[model samples]
Target: MSQNVKVVQRASSSVRDKLYLPAIYDGMKITFKHFFKNLSDINAVDVLRYPEEQPQDITDRYRGLHRLTHRPDDSIACVACFMCATACPSNCMFIEAQEREDGHDEKMPKSFSIDTLECIFCGYCVEACPCDAIRMDTGIFSLTGNKREDFVLDKEQLLANKGAFGEVCSCARD
Candidate 1:
């Protein structure tokens, strides 16, 4: 059996294309055109004054800050499963588990903290949780802090955070 081999010819770059000056000039021309146009009509450019002007288009699907969900009894939903920490690519999650003091065999987190500075906001922790105990639906994209410790959210802070709809509990489970 004989196979036919085809050789494709590559296109050679012209002198102007090699220099790239023309392409650079064209890019600058477009940039300046938009700059001047926006300068003339400020309203043409959509600029949000941030902090004061919150974005109106934050959909339900938007992945923002992480929040720990609560059970119907107002207790934390997390059973100290360690699934979220294992699934975290950034290893920002830190959890300490302990046996529940109540007459239940289920374990609970003694301490659960997430270093927001180190977190990549990948939503893996939320997905890995079997109990739907964790979620990134707080709609708090603008994370700010003076010290690094401020960004590290503990169980209390995480539990305080409400969902995008301003609910403390996961609506899925509720």
Candidate 2:
């Protein structure tokens, strides 16, 4: 194999280029200009008051809160495969698997909980799900709670959080 090398050339600077004051002055000039413009047109600008008013256009790529899909029988679609928990790099996902008591399902989560504080929102859990039982398409960016325990989403909360388009599951078993 032939060796490949890159030669980078640095342009020489003049005396004026060495002076930082001119660059600082130029930056301040632009900053002041924009400041005056914004001050003058403060009323013209539309500011979104969050909690009360949310943005109308929510993109599909926006990763929001995680929700577990439900089967037609009003049961969680998750088979307790643990793919989501295994793929989670943050180790935030916790799942307890148990055999399905009813004849209808294969296996169900005894306790499915996700600590929102530890979750990095990497979307790895969503991608690893083979049954499409878990999704981050809720379009809910703002998640808040008065206490730490409230931020831990349980099975009930995950099931209750339906996406704007509705809960979608493509599991073949269902």
Candidate 3:
């Protein structure tokens, strides 16, 4: 098969265009227009005083921190299936499963930890979950720590995150 190549021609510039004076004036005009407009109505400009003043218009679909959902009986919804850990490309998710002593659930995570430093925030763990147990819709993206250990979120920490935002029922699907 033969492919045809299209020839392109450059647009010819006038003396004014070549001088670049009109472009500078146009840029200055836009700058001054914004300056005057902002001066007249301060609200027209978005000046977020973060940490002190939080944004009011965050959407529900915004992906933030990771959290594990709970069952109606207040127990963890996770079956310790290891699907999330298997799907994680970064290999940041760590989970150890154990038989439930209560005999209610088949299995429970003896230890579950996620190294935030290693995590790429790809949301694959959320997508790979089979029981609708995990979600990234907490909208709490300000994940910071002074020490490396603080970034390693354990099972308790992940569970605590679920309280901030309840179970995301509509997230994971086939």
> Which residue pairs in model 2 clash with each other?
none
Model 2 over residues 29-122: C-alpha lDDT tens digits? 9999988998998987679998799888878788999999987777778989999999999999999999997665678999999999999999
lDDT of 1 by residue, 13-61 (tens): 8888789989899999999999999999998788898989999987778
Clashing pairs in 1: none
TM-score list, all predictions: 0.77, 0.75, 0.65
User: Candidate 2: which stretches are off by over 4 Å?
Assistant: 1-23, 172-174
Candidate 3, pairs of clashing residues: none
Clash count of each predicted structure: 0, 0, 0
Greater TM-score among 1 and 2 belongs to: 1
lDDT winner between candidates 1 and 3? 1
| Highest-scoring model, TM-score | 1
lDDT of 3 by residue, 1-174 (tens): 999999998786888889999889999999999899999998878788988998888777777878887776677878899999999999999999999876556788999999988988999998899887888877787788899999999999888885345554442222
lDDT for 133 (candidate 3): 84
lDDT for model 3 = 0.83
Error of 3 at 126 (Å): 1.1
Error of 3 at 117 (Å): 1.8
lDDT of all predictions, in order shown?
A: 0.87, 0.88, 0.83
